[model samples]
Target: MRADAQKNRDHLLAVAGTAIAEQGVEVSLRDIARRADVGLATLLRHFPTREALLDALLRTSFDELTARAGELETSSAPDEALVSWLRDCVVWTTEYRGVTVLMAAAIEDPDSALHASCVTLRSAGARLLARAQAAGTARGDIDGSDVFALVAMLAWLGDQPSLAPRAERLFGVVASALLTSAGGS
Candidate 1:
């Protein structure tokens, strides 16, 4: 790809980042084009459809998340690291409600970013869970999917800032329960 094409793609992603996060995959391409200060033709030249743009954004965000999870896994105590990651996950999900909604849709599509994202996040979850369980600090029965579910709920709650304090309390309870050693063994 030439430098100009790359530059256009990058610019599109930047504009799409916020738009997609706010409006979701169903957001108008024309709106995105306008926001980027580019024409609809140029926008389509880079991303053919809303789905493609969404897939790219989801791919970019989740990939970064799992990568960060990897770093957290080896950097500290298992329970502490998992808690830290959960906090980070809440923040990320809350940032873009559109992306959050798109992720739900993508997971249903066969060739969506959700499939790859699941694998990535799951691997990170496994590593983190393993360490926590090994140290008797986390429940072994906690599945990777559970963490995703909690994250999704938190993301949805982000829209209602009024409920933040309540959500935080709920999150603390659930996280503590998940991280505590099961059966007191």
Candidate 2:
């Protein structure tokens, strides 16, 4: 990509991220282009589709989450690290309205542009989960996919206006249930 094209793409991604964060994922792409002072054609040229644009916008957040998981793996106890990273995953997935639903679908769609990133995000959680299981802090039966599903469910709850208030408490309950030590053993 040329310098100017790369600059345009970066600016569009920034504007789109803010727009989606503030207005939900349904924000108009044309409006985003206008806000970025770029033509709709140019935006399409860069992103190709709404999912592509979203994939680009969210890729950085996923990468950061993965990196944070790596950091927590060393800095915290296995259980604490898994819990902390799962909490962060919820926050990341729920950053934009409706994003949780998009992610739920994207993670299952091998052709989605966001699939690889989502997989990486889940793998990060999986690493922590494996460590916790090894330490006997978490349930031995649960795997990374289960952890990912739980995070996605929490995020879905976060996206619901009526359920938002209880999401944190629910997360705590679910987290406790998944922890082996919480069984009073």
TM-score of each: 0.86, 0.92
> Candidate 1 lDDT, tens digit per residue, 1-185?
99989988998998988885676556789999999999999988878877777666667767787888889887877888787777777788777664566655555666864677756765676677777888889987877767777777776776576887687777777788877744221
Q: Global lDDT of each model?
A: 0.75, 0.89
What C-alpha root-mean-square deviation, in Å, does candidate 1 show against the real structure? 2.9
Name every residue pair that clashes in candidate 1. none
Where does model 1 exceed 4 Å of error? 21-25, 181-185
How big is the positional error of residue 184 in model 2, measured in Å on the Cα after superposition? 11
- Model 2 earns a TM-score of 0.92
For residues 1-185, write the lDDT of model 2, one tens digit per residue.
Answer: 89988988899998998899888888999999998898999999999999999999999999999999999999998888998898998987788877877777889999999999989988999999899888888999889989989988999899888999999999899888778974321
Error of 2 at 105 (Å): 1.6
